[model samples]
Target chain A: MTLLQVAAFTSDFPDDMVEDEHDIIQFGGKGVSEAIGAILSGLGYSVGELDYQGERGWEFSAGAEGQQIWLLLSDLGDYLMLQVEDPSFMGLRPKYRQFREHFLSGLTDALNRDGRFHDLLWFAAVGDPFGFPDPAGEGGRRPAPQAWRWS
Target chain B: MASPPLQSRARVVTKSYRPMRGIEVVGPLARPEYESPSDIAAKARSAAAAYVDRHPEHRSKAMMAANIAGAGAGVVRGGYHMAKGLVDAAAFVQRAANPLPDVLLGRKTAGQQTIDLAGAIGDYVIEGRADPSRLGRDAKQAVANAKADLFPSATPVAANTADELARRFSIGMNQGELGANVASLAVGGPLAKAVGKAGEVMALQRFPAARYIAQGYSPEAAAYLAEPYSGMGSHWVPRRTKPPSWFVDSDYNVLKPRGITRGEMYELHARVDPKFSTARLPPRFADRSWRFEKSGLRRHGPLAQVWHGMPGATKAKGGGSLAAFGSGAHQLGEEGYQ
Candidate 1:
């Protein structure tokens, strides 16, 4: 099984905001959860409230013809984590990989167009167990695949 | 003429001296039974002065030795003072940064107050040795000054409201719980194995009757309980003894459990009391709040729960059963029951 986690600090965004201990990001008098929901909805994904493993967050599901995708988002104080998992029992690894790549690229593009988000400071991914690359870097437009790929 | 001299000597009244054995004795002198106090004192003074004059080097050596010993003692006393002061200073800073329960309980924190007391006692001894006249005054002043320096602002802020005290108590409780959790997690694997091994060894060391029970020996005829038995023809059968309870199953080779290993007990303990768990970020990550922000990511699902529970996740935050266990254990640890 593969697990993916993507986190970005709210403080790094151009919007002067802070996340409380409850992982609720407050910016422009609107919660980051609401913003994420809006963003996911605008991207043509079906977004809904998710309670996965007793963790409160948002779930995004979408499909185009044959390919289906699922994404889970949870708020961590000062950061947001998006977890992608394969719901189908079909042992297809490449499908999850492709979905992660497309989702990350689309999310990055959306954030860029939002104007409020200044940059993505860090990005990280893990394919297998203990597969984690270093996620340290300065603010930038979008992180290279090499930056988040585990060696 | 000799006879006339002897007669005259025998007369004695006219002679003032006597000759005997080549020595001449003068007339009898007046002898006092005891010397006067003044005379004795004078004689003693003169004798002492003469002795000192004769052994000037000895006097100087004694004086130098006394001075050196005194200086060495002073240096040792000073070193003690400095060391105690530094320790007390460090304790003071630690107590200030993280006020312990003892402070709120209206008691001095452990180790710190004892050190301060020792320092005070040392000061008293030093003062007494250096100057007995100023002993009380000097010792009291030094102690007061040291106390002031070390315990400045240590007075428990009287919590006017119960809510305030409760809040402080909660904060301290949470910190302690976190620390306990971190410690437990750090040593859980080894500790669990050790405990399991110890239990097995204890079971093995029991009396033969109990040991037999632990080895899964069933009660049958006393004759059949022997170590070796001639079964069927000439084939001897060994005792059908089962593995000890410490074994995962009847198989003596496999010590670890197939379903739940010994380490799982420790994980359970951590879940029961996260204070006993030591799972935490490294010091570098923990020290900086920003690092938590930048690196806040975790796994999910039942497999993730088996791997490790997230540190700060709880039931309120929608964590699973592990989180609930953590929360309950944290409360127990905080309440001093765990």
Candidate 2:
């Protein structure tokens, strides 16, 4: 599994919203991907086509502030985990708070309308020092992300 | 003839042996044979055990003696603190009542007197004579609540007299007592456990004789025996409720009159900036989060020097180094503006 190195926000949906793995892969995963794409596009970032890997997960590439960024939306049971990968955007340490504010604000605004996004059971911004270690020790000089749960 | 001769010879030999010049008779068998060190130690231990056994009340009597001594010491210390607190309180009231005499006497400046008064009040509060928890509650609201509870329909400000001060003080004291009682009851279980642990540590450190006795029994049994003496001192000390962050931020200063409400400020902020809205703010802002932010500034800014000088304020929450405060302030400012 890739270590999510940037600031990520996780929102767990109610059991009724996505009951099984199939539902998560089809409805929940697609919804999160589309919402993120729309948010990025609205913010003047050019979003690429959504790449779906069936039950595996889905992801998309986007260009924001003249930097290529990847949005990986994955399913973990009944929740959607959003991780941003910006190769040229530097480490998450310097821009943690900014990224958190921007991501939560955009996602909240996009989802919290007409009670359509009311299925959100919990929402939290994971702090810097994210992701698991590279088992092969190939990711050189990368700082291990610390787990932070900001409610 | 032979029997008669043998008897005569025995009598003659006995008489002659008494006059032998080179032979010496030993006295008391030469102090008996010297015993080994281990045998001597065993004998001593057995003697002690036997003596203790003979006087079954010895252990209880020793424990009682220790308890009495400890209790006496606790009482003395408690009384000292209580008296000191009373003196400080009296000094504070005197200065607060009339500041001109001290100023004219050139003993203390107005600022010095104010600092002293604050310190005295702090000592009083820390001594548990006053409720430190009540500092965070709106002052006006507290006074109103106290009035409603004690003297219904009587406003504290209506009478600007000594009697009014007395009445308000009485009400506050009652509230403080109630708060202390409630707090004690709430934390009774955990407090007892903590006290027990502390007592165990104290007993191990202070009593070598008890430890020797304890070696003869199981650890659990020994702990039970030493438990009573462990908490003797703590029993006399009052449980302290931590003062609120705002109180610490106020420079160990007395509570001030609140001028504005968070809601009103939120409304004002909304009106000033078109982009500003309550929806954009974190949910906690609706509650006491604004006060936390304000307090954070004092902890993380120029006001920190004053807080650091306070007795226990520096150890309290948000009372960190200047660099930490800078980081906290930056985070708070970012959230506040957002």
Winning model by TM-score:
1
lDDT of 1 by residue, B1-338 (tens): 11122222222321111121222333332222123422432332233333334545434332222222222222333333334456757866777666676566666554555466578779878878888878777567766543432231323432332222222322222222233334336674344334334433432222112222112222111111212311111000111122344432223221122333212322332332211211111112221111211222322223333223322322235447656665565554434321
TM-score of model 1 relative to the true fold? 0.28
Every model's TM-score: 0.28, 0.21
lDDT of 2 by residue, B161-251 (tens): 2233233333333333333334346674344334334434453344323332323432222222333221101100111122565543342
Please compute DockQ, using alpha carbons, for every candidate against the native two-chain complex.
0.01, 0.01
Worst lDDT 10-window in candidate 2 chain B: B230-239
Q: How displaced is residue A76 in candidate 2, in Å?
A: 2.9
Error of 2 at B53 (Å): 66
Q: What fraction of the reference structure's interface contacts does model 1 contain?
A: 0.00
Model 2 lDDT per residue over A1-151, tens place: 1233323233433322233421121423666677668777886668888865322245687664544556656543323445554443353444643553555445445654424443332212222111222111223222223333323
Maximum-lDDT candidate? 2
User: TM for chain B in all models?
Assistant: 0.17, 0.18
